[model samples]
Target chain A: MPGALHRVLFVDLARHRSWVEDRADLYSESLGGAGVAIELLREHCPERCDPLAPENPIVLAVGPLTSLYPLASKTVAMFKSPLTGNLGESHCGGRSAMALRLAGYGAMVIMDRSPTPVYLSVDAGGVRFRDARTLWGMSSSLTAGRVMLEREGGAGHRTVLRIGPAGENLVTYAGVTVETYRHFGRLGMGAVMGSKHLKGIVIAGNGDLPVADRGAYQRTYRDLYTRAVRSPAMRKYYELGTPENLGPLSAMGALPVRNLQATGYGTEPPLEGEALAREHLGRRLACSHCPTACIHLAALREPHPEAPYFYKTTFVSYDYEPLYALGTMLGVEQPEDALRLLDVVEHLGLDAMSAGVALAWATEAFERGLLDEKALGGLRPAWGDARVYATMLECIARRAGPLYTLLGEGVDAAAAEYGGDSYALAFGGLEMPGYHTGPGAHLTHLTGARHSHLDSAGYAFDQEDMKAGQSRSPKELARALLTEEARRQVLSSLVVCFFARGLYDADTCVACLSAVEKERNWDDLMALGEDILRRKHAFKAREGFEFDALRIPARTLEVPTPLGGLSENTLREAISEVERLLASGERFSHG
Target chain B: MGKRLRVVDVERCVDCLLCAFACARRFGGGGLAKSAIAVRSVGGMERGFVVVVCRACEDPPCLAVCPVGAIRKVEVGVRVDADRCIGCSMCVEACAIGAVQWDAVERKPVICVHCGLCAQYCPHSVLAHEEV
Candidate 1:
């Protein structure tokens, strides 16, 4: 291990005292990234502490492979979620991982809430806290990022992670946007930072990393880079980006439409990937050391409301989740309107998925007469009304009125207060992700700790089942998802993007790991992956999460999927079986 | 067998820094510490990046500033004699682009050897090894 690998940088916002401590034990066992971050959170976070309180600790970590390998670009941020009041973990990509790693530290732990708005700047040598009073409360969060870029020293080699007014206002679903387009998009991690009066974090560093075997490492790196750039899976991402999934998901009836009220929206011209590629896609972007370049920036050319002759073009990045959440889930028919809504959410620095679900719930509430102009403060909530949705999204971030405040808390909390729990598109208190495949998808969300479709990729498993015609018992499905998710812990710990799962199979990963540190073999790697998953689940369980506590939205079962209509009983049975399998100490073996 | 290495068109560089990685890997066994060239954002990434490497100046300030006579003008570019380097960091300060990278771990200065390994790895033809 490098001499600097053991040191943890500690930043105190109130006192502005920063220090580094050598904790090699944590790094040696946990292996950095989410693994070490979780350990730090356990030690620093007070039990049942208020997530927004000065006591809550935010830990960001980078793995050993960062900046040394391709696709190891994600930074793991772990803290108590202000949204769910449980263990919070969000992974982000941009220049964050490389910056943090190069900055001569393995991890950073921020604690002690600030008295006033501030941002932390870290370089290769030291850390400094700067007052952000002038930069705070900016409507366009990008303005703050631009200011930081100009004022701060590091330019291309640094990452600036900033929050918008949404986070400043403490919107529970607010997120921290980094490198302009990348985000710690889920679990209200931004709200935690805002609660501490933290406006942003900027990191820049340039240092040579020490390795065990330079010759083997270099050869392996070239091989991985070659494979990453040439893979077919990577080509799809580079070409159409994630929006490519939008068309196929919609066609397969997996796209969540109108808050999952309908699986398919016939009235709307399908907002598919192919359509966006033909019309809106302006440019492609990628994270540092990443060749996929899957980021799609869409150019929306529109006449400025004030200046009709002068048309202003806005470029917004679009993806599968955002497209589904803001377009189909909100009943938005016109692609332009969806893009506009996406632009508003992006500027606000709120999670588009949660914001769309919140808005969809509000629209449904209004349609059912559960909410009216009185509750909405004279603002009519309607589906497919992009203008109304845009205004409401901003209002929600700003916490304007009673309705906006409720909506800002997310769909689960909003529905609980407004009598629409039946249609609330949430799982494990977090809003549902884009997928609505079938019983498999719902079951995956219910069983997975994150309650996210990515938890177990149940949709992909559904596709596999379609091909295999093998109806394994619910236990079999749960075991498979759990094993796959556990294996992903290795990827996430290395902080690699999940999109590259095909490229970094277990064998390839072992080969790469051997280049860095030859001590560990394939089995050791697998064990570490399992241990990390268990640790994450333990944190969730400690926060009162139970497999049975998972709620399959009433709307999901009501809507027929492309696979078939998912029955409540089947989903419930699967959930119970999954719980049983999880409770039992059965080691899931992946062949 | 010595060859002069210079960047042909920097505008084509996507800021990937593959050349730097490749340079480091070519010498350091496989790690990034040994790479002689460095890439940094010029101002903001929106503006673009600047590739920092030895310009192979006729009167290289790095060589003149080395207190321990550690730097020498090689056939292709400047090379560092690690045995004599006292970790003085004079060469690093002498170079304007900060191309003379100081290895804090190894207590030595890393100067580009003009090997052109980086140019071979750069998929985009942003970096070129030219005999000037």
Candidate 2:
């Protein structure tokens, strides 16, 4: 903690009271970002507390490398999720990390509910709670973000973290949008913010961070920049962003389609990255300190239904996950329709992955006669109907009816309530992401901490393993996943973007840390990563989340992947082995 | 050779602010205060961005208007002699690009030294050094 000056800012919305506390102990041991934030939540959040209640603390923390290093620009938000009913952690990149770190604070904790709508503004000097009645109840999240951006003095210096109507109305899976594009897009963090009557948080700081060795810092910074710019991985991200995955996934017949019932969309038109770039890509965007401007904005041109000469062009950003979830996953063939649906979910502040999965479930349910037209409020639930899906998204955000309310909770809960858990398309309550590549991908979803594909990168593992014709036993696969997840704790603790994994290997990470802070060595970093992973697992266990209780949806086995038929029993056995390995306290070194 | 500052093109700027960081790095400082140039979102980033810095005016109102004779033409651009400055507001108001940043801690005007160091770091062709 010699390097980290831990400052925690606590805001009480109801009384408009705010104070700062320096908790050096948290940072000294756990470091910051996800590690420290998780510890803070465990200490502050009461067990069995209502996730959206005032008692539940919403904690946001930035890692030590934030603002000082490139691609380490993510802020981790930790709170009890209204949707997941367990430990919730979401990583978002935008101005959040830089602004928070620059504002002279390591973490922000919000407690108590506000009597009326309000937003918090934190700067280098001080913090203020501004009344947001005028900006409240806005349907469009973009409008709310714009209002805060204009009203706040830090035009380019601050991040405007705001929730849309979905959050305002307490949609169970509502996410908080940051910088208008990036989001804490899972586990109902926005709903928690809304429950506290907090609409947004704007942060700006002009304070200079102290470096132990300026010369070394400068040298390393230059070296990292050169590596980042020159790396082929970085180039792919820069040119096409994440949407580049669409083409390969589709080619391999691994793109999730029709709620995991199929892997390919039977459309003649090429709905891949090349086609998207040719037809729709308008601009590219980058997160703070990221040289790879991978975020592609698609300019969707639409003619007015009535007027001949009144065409309008709107820019909607696309990534592989959003495209998969809203497009092929929902059997949406038209790219325009997919973009429209993406726009709707984004505008309403719903998690695009969860929303798409929920829609797919509803469509399947309606088709199977489990849900009828009456249940859908006379709105037909069909795959590829963009107009109806867009309207349904609105209904979901508003919680218009019983069905919408259930759908808003996410696919697992919705399917459970509607009787389709077998085809729910969820892993541990959170919906599955786009990939359906092979056993590795499915197993990763079944066992990864957040049930996110990014966790342990099972899809990447699958791709590599397939090429090599290498196979792992259940125990070996579990060990590999757990080891990778453990190592990633170090990365996430630094809060670096996972895209820079190749660049920031253990050696490089240690070098960078030593150059700046000079206290930690490689061994210490590895041990810290393992400890953090254990702590996360402990938290999950306390919340009744058992690695054994995890369910591999029947549909995963029923539908044959391009690789082979994956068995659920094998996945479950793997989970059991992982549980044993974790219990044994055995550590595996990559080298 | 006196120091000179240059901006290449406003339209070409991606607004990554690598120049700003590079300037800060050149000074061996870890903050934006050391940077000579600034980039701000114009209206919103969706619209575009504006990179602001000293254009180094020919008449140089900054030099002419300084009562304490603190402002002078340097190799990069017009710079305020930090030792000679009286923390007066005269030159700050005179500069067109609002490049004369105030160091509240030092109570002095931080005028651009126009070293073209920022231009070297601009990955995009938004900033360039030129001889007059």
Candidate 3:
């Protein structure tokens, strides 16, 4: 193994001291990325710790194939979630993984809290705590990024992970904007950073990496790069990006529209990805080491309100999740209106999925007379009210008022406090991602350790079942999802984007591992992945997560999916099956 | 005639860093340590990127300013003789375009050899190699 991959960096914000530790065992046995990051989190995090407290550590990790292979671009960030109050794990692309890996550490653990606003400047030398008082409280995170681009060196080679005023206000779903387009967007890592008074973190390096076998490394890189660029699987991503799914999912009656009041747009939706691309696409970008540039930035041109002739163009990044949450889910039909709401959320650096779902609930509550206009802070929650949504989203992001503060805690918290618990869309404190496919989506949301769709991708499983024209039994479905989740841990541990799951199978991963570290087989990875997932579940269990006590939102059962109405009893059976499968897992040992 | 690598389409570059990685691979390893090419965003990514490498100047400033006479003009660009180099970095200072990449570990300037490996792996046809 490369000597550098064995190194871990630890920083205490309170003392403002930074140091590196050589733990060869951590990397050699567990491998890199989440494999080592989860172990570090277990050691650093205290039991029954406050999610916002200094006891909760933020562990950012990169894998062995990070710089050596294409599409190995993600950095896994694990912490105690301010939203879920359980295992908080988010993966970010952009230059983050490459920056941290090249900065000469496989993993970084940030602890303690700063008394004043500050940002960590990390390079090959060490970490520097710079005062960010001037940059703090900026409404737009993009403005802060621009200031950072000028003030700091390592342009192109460095990543600036920063939060906006929403984070400063401690919005529970606030996300850390990575560079300009990507994000650690789920489970509120930004809020955790906010609680610690950390404004931003910049990682940059111009360091060398040692490859165990140069010839094998070159061969593997060539094969992977060719496959990534040449394959049809990735073409969909680079061509039109993820918004490509908006039209299909909507047509298939899987898309959630108007707070799940209806599925599908019923007609050719105006906010379809192809239409958005043709009308608003400004640029396409790639994460470091990724050939497919899937990050699509839309050019939203708007004239200044007072000066009609003058215009200011903004570039907003859009995806399928945001389109569902902020667009169709709110009955937002106009492409520009959807883009505007998306821009507002992006500027605030809040998780769009959570914000959109929270807004949907608020609108429903208002419709049901559960929330009056006074409780809504004199703002009305109406469907497709983009102007109103723009203000409301801002309110939620900054926690501007009492109502907004409740909304910022996520829909579950708001519903628990207010009288709208029945329709609130959150499964386990964390608001659901944009999928309303069937029982599968809800099952994953309820049982997945992070309470996130990416945790198990049950939406895809629903689609596959739809294609086959048959649905599996509850026990069969649970076993399949658990197996997939464990297998995905392997890819996640390598820290690659899940989009590349087709490429990095067990054999291929083992082959890649041989070029950097010692030879390890597929069984070793399977065992390691299972062990890591069990540990995450163990953490969540310790943190008061009860699978049986999972809430089944009334809206989930009321809405008829493409797969027909999901049986509540079947959903419960699936949950029990997951518990059973988890118990029958083998343990991994450190060699 | 000399073969040299050049930017074909600046707008087409996706900022993947494959060209830079391929350049570093010529050094027989991974990472961007000894890469001669640099691709950086012009302000922000929305504005596109600027690719910097040896422009193969006829009367190279890097060759002219070398205090130890370690740099000499080759067919197109100049070559640095590491044995004679004193690690003064005068050549690096003299290159106005910042094409002379300094290696901190070796205390030497890493100049592009015009190997065309960067062009072959560009994925998008943002780079090109041609006889000039």
Candidate 4:
């Protein structure tokens, strides 16, 4: 390995001290990202430690391929989630991986909570915990980002990961926003930051790396770059971005509408991707080293309510998940309304998926007379009412009322506390991602490490199986999903975007790893991936996670997917298969 | 063919820093420290980006300011004589566009040779190899 890849930076927020340590052994064995992170979490996190306590640690790791390979731009953030009260891992892309790699570290372990609100600035000069007492209560995360950007000043190469009011309030599902567009948007990473009184993290670096074999490096780099830009897999992302899935998903009757009460967007033109792009696409952006500029910014131009003949243009990012969560799930029918709601979510630095699902539950609860006007704080729960949703989003972020406080804990906790557990859409403590494809989608969310769709990409499996005109047995499907998730451990450890999985297959990943690190082969990487998966599960199990005790919302069986309503028996059988697969992972080792 | 790299579209640049990486690879390394080209956002990325590179100026300020006669005007762009140079960075200071990037490790100004290596790897075509 290059000497740089072995370095780990440790930040003690309690002591306000920062130091660097060279852990070549750990890097040599784990190869960074989730592989290294799981180990770091175990070492630093005390057994039965409070998820919000100072004893819990935050691990942000980048891989050997980071800053050396194209599209290897994701940074894996691992911590014990306060929401799930178990293993928490989230991956974000922007300049995060590159910035960390350039800032002269392979991984960073932040522990010990700050006594007061503070933000960590990491540049070539090393880590400095700056006083952020004044910046703490800023209304929106965007303003907070702007303040940090102006104060820190790395501009293009720097990544500012900051949280908003939601995080500051310790909203369980709040996320740490990356570069204003991307996020470590799952598993309550922001709440962890908030609990430490750590408001944000800033990283900037200009240094580069040394490739062992330049000839092979260049050849492989060119091949990956060419494929990333020119491939058909990336074309849709480049054109309309992830929102391109909006049309197809809606047409296929897989797009969740009105809290999964409906599965399709019925005759709604504004909710479609093509219509939104044509009407509102302002610009497109990409994470560092990624050719596909999948982050689509919609220019929402609306007339200023107070000023005549004046209009305000707000650039809001739109994607399939957020569109489904904030738009369709909340019954937001108009594009502008959905965009406005998304703008609120982004401003508050809340996880759009979790927040949307929580609100969906609230709306249903309100309509069913379980939640009255007193609980809603004068806001009525009505379908397609963006105004009501907007006010409720603020209330939840602030934990303003009895209902909002409960909802702030996420859909599972909210429903459990408030008598709507059956309708709550969360699979684990974490809420469901925007996929109503079939049994595979729900099964993946339940069985995957993070309770996220990206963990196993079960929706893709559903689409593929549908195209093949066949459905596998529950056990067979479990094997396929688990295989993909296991292989993805390599990708996440290398910290590459999941979108580029086709380009960075196991062999290609091994080739890339060999160029950057020493004493590693394809077999070692495969074993390391399996070991990482086991370690993550071990962490979860240690923290009281139970596979058999996993909850599949009753509503999941009620909603008719594209393949019709999923059978409970099949979903339960899939979970059983997952348990057997995980038992094998326990025996796997990194050696 | 004497091809010079040009910032064809600043708006199209995603600030990926691939061009910078490509330039550094010419010296058998990875990083922006030795690269002559620099891509930075104008305050914030949502606004846009600014791609800083040598314009291959007529009667360049860098060549004029070199006290030891280390820099010479080449066919398309200026080249630095590392042997003759005292690393004064007068030439770097002379350039108004801030295209004269300083190598922190070597303590010398790294100027663009207009080799057009950066243009080839530009995925978005933000940079172009213009044939003069």
Which number leads on lDDT? 3
Q: Would you list the clashing residue pairs of candidate 2?
A: B2-B75, B3-B74, B3-B75, B3-B76, B4-B75, B4-B76, B76-B114
Give the higher-TM-score candidate: 2 or 3: 3
Tens-digit per-residue lDDT, B53-79, candidate 1: 888888899999988888888777787
Tens digits of per-residue lDDT for model 1 on A1-591?
343666789999889899888888897887778789888998998877888889999999988677778778789899988777787888898888877887788899999889899988897667888899998899977888878877886522588999998999989889999977789999898888889899998998666676777777877887888888778888888788887777667666778888887776432347778788899876656677776667777888998889659998777888988888999888897889999998898889899988999988888888899898888877897778999888888889899987789888888888877888889888887888888776677777777766677767888888777667766566677677777777777787777888888998877787776777555666777677777777777777776777766777778877887667878777777777666655665566455
Candidate 4 stretches with Cα past 4 Å from truth are A1-3, A154-156, A266-269, A585-591
- Candidates 2 and 4, the one with greater TM-score: 4
Question: What lDDT tens digits, residue by residue, belong to model 3 across residues A309-412?
Answer: 99998888989899889998899989899999989888998999999999999999999998899988899989999999999988887787788999999998
Q: Candidate 3, which CAPRI tier? A: medium
Cα lDDT tens digits for candidate 4, A1-591: 322877899999999999888888887777789999999999999988998889999999998888888888899999999889998999999889988888788899999899999999997667988899999989899888878878986532588999999999989888999988899988888889999999999998777688788877887788778888888988887888888787778778888888888777544534787888899998888888777888888999999989899998888998988988998898898899999999999999899999999999999998898899987898898888999899999999999977898899988888877888888999878898888888889888999988889989999989988888788899888888877787889889887889898888767887776665553676767677777887888989989899888988888898788777788889999999888878865432221
Candidate 1 chain B has its poorest 10 consecutive residues by lDDT at B40-49
Please list, in the order the candidates appear, how each scores on TM-score for chain B only: 0.91, 0.85, 0.95, 0.97
C-alpha TM-scores of all predictions: 0.91, 0.96, 0.97, 0.97
Off by over 4 Å in 2: A1-5, A154-156, A265-269, B1-5, B65-67, B86-90, B103-107
Q: DockQ order of candidates, best first?
A: 3, 4, 2, 1
Q: Top TM-score: which candidate number?
A: 3
Q: Please identify model 1 stretches exceeding 4 Å from their true place.
A: A1-3, A154-156, A265-269, A308-311, B1-14, B29-113, B129-132
lDDT (0-100) at residue B108 of candidate 2? 71
User: Relative to the unseen true structure, what is the C-alpha lDDT of residue A315 in candidate 2, on a scale of 0 to 100?
Assistant: 78
Structural RMSD, model 3:
2.1
